[model samples]
Target: MNRRHARRQGMIALALTGAMIALAGCAPEPDVQPTPTPTDSAVVPYDGPVVFVGDELESFLLTPAEVAEAIPEATGVMNASAVLEQVSDGGGTAAVPAICDALFAEQSLGSVGARVTRWMTPSDPEYGQGRVEVLQFADEQQARDRMDQLLQAAADCGQFTKEAPVTFDAEILDEVDGVRAFAGTLLDIDGGYDWRVFQAYAAVGNVVVMLNQPFTGDRTYDAQAAASLLQQRAGDARDALVADLTENPPVPEEQPVTDAAQPWSEWAIGVDGVGPVLLGDAVDVAVAAAGGTATPPTFDRGPWIVENPEATASMLIQQAEDAETVWYVTVGTRRGESAETPQDGAALPALGDVRVGMPVSEAFAALPGGTIVDVASSGEDYYAVTTREGRLFRFDTEGDAADGTAIIIGITVEDATQRASLRFG
Candidate 1:
């Protein structure tokens, strides 16, 4: 027999041995399904507020469009339910059966509900994979306990010799706040493949977010890069969940505004000699006004760049090809040991008298006549303020609201109503 056939035969022999052991009480049954529990009794009613009520997994889960943004070469997204069904039908390895048993065991996840999404490239049939699994629990404590269980399970199952001579090597990557990250490799001897996997777990309020990426290819995959990406994605997901839950929980109807608010269109920033610029202005006019040249378009977009001769200030502009208007402008102070102000006549772009480094309160006071519609935390110490006029300002605070100062860091102007509708509703 050929070497490949001989290897398959050997794997079959091992699998049979594993199956016999499993039947003899060494492993749990693969087909044991989780018992259905009443949704209300399963989880305690989130007492404070609800960003997501019921099982709207689609809203919190990363969509295929987002996956495309993260993994540019992603070909398609697979319905996680279908993938799970396939895994079930395949009658996975002996170890997999036991793992599922532990996962779905009574109270293991504490009234938890899960939804998964997977992104795949053309090569995924043989290698490469991306997936995000979100588990919503009864409370923050439950989510934390579940994460602990998952990490311990990974540690316990360090390696499996049955069914394909598989081996796992795992290491703790990082633990920030309540989030834990782990990275490892899976060696499949029978399949002739080595999979590099990175996993991150975070408990945000009453939810647990898990992001995992597994890749296999001819070229060596960088584990550090994969771990970093997983950590970033996990952190972003956790922040979004917390923001949604705490700031704008689900309500039956729109909350009435008690104070008068002005539109954001009145705000303007200087673009060099072009006088003042507002949202929806054409890209060429804005670039010329800023005394900068636009680069050739690629992927239907171009960037207008500006740099200070004295290395004190810089700006980057992005414009879309389908629209004549400039999209967004990012103005920032120069990095390193340089002094704050630009030399000679160079001046940093300004929204009225406000620029980066201005106190958060001062920036709002400088605005012509807009009301602070909402203030929400995006991540740890980072805050975003939205105005009635389609303007969003971001700031970083030292820590506490009373003792620490909030410094303006970035600003963006967009259609406020549309943005709110998409995010909150």
Candidate 2:
């Protein structure tokens, strides 16, 4: 939540929100479309077949006409993901389910390919939202395992609590063409009626299709109809995926820039670079170094935070306050009595001088005071300061500054040096 950084929209937030509050009866959609941006003129030419997980998945997705066919009240259906720039730090959750804390628990496990199609009926007032998620597992057996997990969870997920009481129950309605349908009800925690919910799933080969749509109002959840639709779509996607695999087309395998044989990746976290990323790298380059995504420090594209789930460290990258292009990368770390702890991506201590799990004073001592550039007062207290030597970092301490045991909780090795001279004009 850096004041200077524009937070990326909460992807979990809804375009459905405006539609839900629309006046009763269908109406023309609000001007929810974004002012279009420049399209990349670089559409690389490719011969033969391409992988179905990315650009190809769109064709396999339910068409706008198809969704409109189901939720006839829908006024306009746009590519929610492509059109809307959401603020992820803002509150609101997705139709994302972890039903009974079992289904969708480990999203990454056995996942070979995945894609989502989100369509918002932004003027429907009801039945204007749904997500079609296609996930390819390692094999057919794995796909079935996911299906089994969901079914079992549904059986035991009669009730659960998420900040309040919720009652989610479902029953097998039908299974046609290998697609299983579940007609369910979602009861509001405030003792409301059981709202209808539709869940359709189908597994073909190594791929799985999940169509989840909540029955908001006049548009009821139809398990049978949805199941039939999913069965056909899943079968098609699976076939395409298999065909691609057989053709063995060489799609650019996404690899972190850090995975390359560069010494900078192992170098200390300095103004030059942090892990696989470097100071002033553009969004695309930094994203590549972060295993394909640089998580926003608070869900915004600006001030991107890169983390390695396998380790205990993280880094932040941000543009200069008012300029474009990335300015610098920061490694949030702490001082340590011992350097035994692991880092988020790279080896700790940033050249053995400053490392997380170390003492705050020691870190600051190595890189002394400078001009304060930013302040963090929410949830923590710290100062982001810059130095004449082209260094910017934040040190959040515990207890009094004099106490040796006051371990640092959050430390950032940021930079504002190079950005000071940007041509912001």
Candidate 3:
């Protein structure tokens, strides 16, 4: 495996190992309630809706507009599910099993509502990027419980090693107020660069907050800056939740469920230039559709990598040697200082007409039979839509819900979890 791929796999393995030790209940359980502290005055009884709608976060977290203002050129937002599914650059075989086991476990915040917005510089997209995730729990106690579990897990797995000589060291930083923070570093012995991450977790009544800032370059990362930012943002979120509760008192009654069926629209799945294509199309046809010149498939008995150098897009087409059919196709964009150059206003080559940069509202409007089965937002009126056909689309809007047009930032066909292994080899 290449150095990049090895490093990613190693980092994932280390995380999973730590999570396993933590989830195994290796540490003794402490008192569920935190010690009596000054911050206790800040806790407020949550009376808002228990079942959360993504946009409700605007009452407590930073809006998309706010994030864009802070970091211009910020791409669209990603909901909680999308964040969990974000794997490292190189697809590693060993990391997948571990990530699935730990990240998807029953108590791993899957029950709560969450969303993440990422920020990266135009010059160095890979290194100087950060993410903020807000998780809303049923109540304060549950959030605290989850935090405790994460702390225990971090303690049990201090350091570990994985294949490709990758070593990971995790440290539990000092706690602030009642919140806990941690830092981790991953180093590839043969690779030139290292990956560093700083995370802070705080529980404010029913809202649980997490701040993750990752740097993947040669320079020394500023741990203090990362921690301070986390503290500030977490504090802001906590205070906002409290103020919202006091200002807008919620009716202490359960929300009634609606039984009316939503209208459905039929969608044509194809890239604008690349007409409709299925999961198993040949590499050349798929590449041409993506606005790239076709090249002969090079088989080393593995997935073929196709690139549209001009469009800054690439695809990984997987198929077995014995079978004439393709198993799955994964497409992505290269973003960095030395990344590929694309024409102005060119759409990403993943799904053609429905690719990134398309307006979310316009994309949905084009689908005659598409029904929004689920919708989530992370402030700024951004939303993640799930269709009845299992396709996932994320949109980032510019203004108020009534007038703002939602731009498409992400799309996933079929089951994203199984995208890597859709068919047997």
Candidate 4:
């Protein structure tokens, strides 16, 4: 990739996030594509969007505490789905340029995985809300190339359509805390080309953290003030994520595994249910079966969350508008050396002795005809196994394929759905 050297040479003051921050979607089954033999071209990543592979990608995302630190005056914190809305902005009557479409955050950056954090600050009216999002590419090269695309968009795109058509102009700001920054302004076509909106961007290694402070109501828009605020927050967010990942790399749950008389071990996961829990089971019925308590949903259509009595494990139940029927169940834990109950009373069976914290290869052997969606790697990876009886078992694991030990941290049992959102694509 070639580098762009042209610069205006002064620092612009900065401002961006999505629906749920981190791996926060409760949408049950993911529509996966077969793994294509990978090629050398950076332009074409894979035949399909390589996803559910990066385990730490979620860990790399900013946390609520971090978001709070950035927006001290925030009234409240929005859930993960809000981050999705923060990043996605290409809806209107015309074809908006990709750059202008993602003035706040770039949801379609084509990364392997992404995590986001969002907040609302009513105190500052000019910049209504605030957001911080971290996007992860497969490697450093892909991340750099994606940054180049964003910069190009900023430099070339000056016009796009919103509810009202507008003209955009960008100024490349100085890099702060090792993150390249940019300031952008949007002018109304009907309002005599006056500045109406402001946003900012920060491009770092193998990641792009963005900030957005959109106007809440009609207020005097000051481009410099908005830029400065966005810049400070973006730098803070980028630093926080880097420090979190560096200081606290995820630790695998390597607990003792003693084969004991358990309940779900003898039970096989079929298209029906594990034991008493079956598909189309109501929320109360499913929670009763798991012996867990149901918590409130975070987002509007968020899944029903079930917590164990001891809060050791969790189960996410997804059901459409009929109150609780037509259910999809999800539960996971780190697979140990052998079949061992993770917590004392929360004896969640290994779903026929196959659980997380175990090698993905073992899961493949246990459930044959299981296809590998993304190539397995060291940090975090995923594998999807479909049973002969039409049951889908998806695993998100840590470790490496070279050592034949990618430990599972998350697993879900789901049926197919057409309205599912693509995480990577």
Candidate 5:
């Protein structure tokens, strides 16, 4: 009505609008539903009777001529019934009907079963590991299709080479009401015939039924009568895919180092007092009290024996590539010592690093074959020399000194095979 009243009404309306907007912001949104993915309906799960079923593989069937070739003795049989009877007679024992029902009764035709048995024949390497698949399949089609895939998978995994395929063919057999009953040449695959067959019947729909016999053995697996005996124990699920093949061990890579790659100078300790000893010189400074030198006289001790003398001496001077120290032979008869005044030992006067691949070995041999000596390996390349004194003197090549490291050459012997192992430290 009045201008002020109208302004107040407008303000109230603006406040109401702001409140509505805030409430809308705080309210939760509706939850969105996820889309369902489509899956194939043809994938029949592995039920008890039918282990596996492949539409394409099941369609494959052998012709009458192929069947006749598979079983030569059944050639003159008038009908399928005659062949069936023969197969039953060959199949030694009948399986319980209840075992067959568990595999096929509840499902469509793609069921599978297994049987349990021991493989004791000489031809079977797994004879020690008893085999069992005491289950059944809905019918022959399902059984054959699954077996084909399984066999192929095994071959692909290199379990069996293509040139050598494991084969088993037997006969089909059934007893009607405890009396002898028969089913014809039950199944044939890849040139192998099976006369001993265990049937797993499945009622797909109405009167349409399927019989699957997972274990079928031909004459090769056993003679006619023997084949039948194998069937009596049949009626179990197909073998589980747990144990199919083995694995291969891994091989290590090879690493080798040449003579030029050895580290020698790393053994160099310091070049102070010990350096002159290896360089064939000795030094004397002031002594706290005073010192004196000793003289020696050679004696006729015939021969002297020293064990690991050179190695022990080298160990003391090994790291002294640049140092010097006194060296002396002790407690041995000298070659020129008189018997009346025998020489107990001698101060060699000076010590030097025995260089190898040169005149070191020759010099040591000139003194005597048994004379102990320190040998140090040296060359432009890497090298190592062990003297008669059991000392391992290592010398670094130019590259080794530059790298400031040592190379280790390891030799391994395995089963008459000699291999060289190399490592850097």
Candidate 6:
């Protein structure tokens, strides 16, 4: 067709389509957009204040030993809900002193968690060295029960004594160790219970709590009064806590898993020119010539060092000539001595020395930061083992490695386990 004819045809088709649209405007139409589904991201994280370690109050109904042992065998494998279930299993009609009725029950309140802020001993005149511990339980019911028991014990003890005519003004110290309660009680022999008060409330689930209150002998204040005070405080705290929790929740922190053996190895030893000799497997020496008896040092979990005078003579000469570091590593010795600075009697020659103790890990930690140079080579082990301070430590078997008793010479004291396996440099 010619161009003019085609243009005319197109115009006619456009007119027809416009006429159809105009007619459809009078008819009804169906909805086009579909309903949107919600996602996890659509829900926000809990908005709450950062809980300081020492902000909450914890009262224990059980002894420290009892509470510590209360975890089920399967706790290590359980989730939060599972752990909570286990905790609630044996927890009976115990009330929580630091929470409200609305928030104290596990069934109603759910689980809460927090960090430890402070620990203290109660200074009440009657009790001596009363041990109190504070922990942020993962469940509000847990915290409440702990506090409830604590208050109950205090009140029950107070009821034992008869009323006395003594009355003294009480003081509350903000001490972390709970000495304030003791000190206050001591100031007035008459007003014992009145001198100290403990209360717990929820601020946030992740908030910190204090545990340290000793029971002193003088029970002058009304026990019921003290218990009431604790209960009220707990209620107020719980409400505040719930409001805070509903607004803001705690976020899990990123925890970094570290190679326990190599954590300090590079920075503390091998990478920094700490050693001039690669002493993993290349130490040779004559026992008698090395100045001690012709016997190898015994290896154990404790530190290792040359304790014999005979070995000292040989090792000192070698160190003086080579200007290289020597070591005695042990696993069982106490702190304050290391390979670099052994106690005068503790450090002997590596050669024929009697086994003097050397704190292996400490010595490694004590090395002047830029000393050991790490050498990468497989030691005498079939499986992989970590190297520390440029020295790859390996024993004859995995059992030795697990216990940390690898014997080699020219090695500086690293820790107790390494100390026992001393070889002459």
Q: What would the TM-scores of all predictions be? A: 0.34, 0.39, 0.38, 0.37, 0.15, 0.26
**Candidate 1 positional error at 7, Å:** 99
Best by lDDT: 4
- Candidate numbers sorted by TM-score from highest down: 2, 3, 4, 1, 6, 5
Count of clashes in candidate 2? 17
Clashes of 3: 12
Model 5, residue 328: distance off in Å is: 92
Among all windows of 10 consecutive residues in model 4, the one with the lowest summed lDDT is 7-16
How close is each model in CA RMSD to the real structure?
A: 29.6, 27.2, 26.9, 26.9, 32.1, 20.5
lDDT of each: 0.45, 0.48, 0.42, 0.49, 0.24, 0.27
Ranking the candidates on lDDT from highest down gives 4, 2, 1, 3, 6, 5
**Model 2 lDDT tens row, 1-425:** 33222122222223446544342223343455577999878543443322233233444567777666545544445552311111213222222234454432333233433456666656544556766666544344555666766666667667765434566556564555454445355554443444445555665554566665655553455445555666666666656655655555453312123333443334455445555666566755765665522555453435665554444555556665655556665555333211232444333325345444456556546644321111122233333333323344555555433344455545554443333210100
TM-score of 1: 0.34
Which prediction has more favorable TM-score, 5 or 6?
A: 6
Q: Relative to the unseen true structure, what is the C-alpha lDDT of residue 203 in candidate 6, on a scale of 0 to 100?
A: 20
* 1-425: candidate 4 lDDT, tens digit per residue: 11121111111111012333222223334455688997765442222211122233343344566554444465566654311222233343432554554443344334433445567777766656666555544444555565665666677667766556666677776666655667566556463434355555555555555555455334333444434554565456545554554454433222224222335333344455444555667756765676556665666656666555555655566675444563456565323211122432224445556764567667767754333333312233455543312245666666442234766665666543212222211
lDDT score at residue 151, model 3, on the 0-100 scale:
55
Tell me model 5's lDDT, rounded to 2 decimals.
Answer: 0.24
Q: Which runs in model 2 stand beyond 4 Å of their true positions?
A: 1-52, 80-114, 120-128, 135-144, 155-185, 188-196, 205-208, 215-219, 249-262, 265-425
Q: What TM-score does structure 4 among the candidates reach?
A: 0.37
Best by TM-score: 2
lDDT value, candidate 1, whole model: 0.45
lDDT of 5 at 159: 20
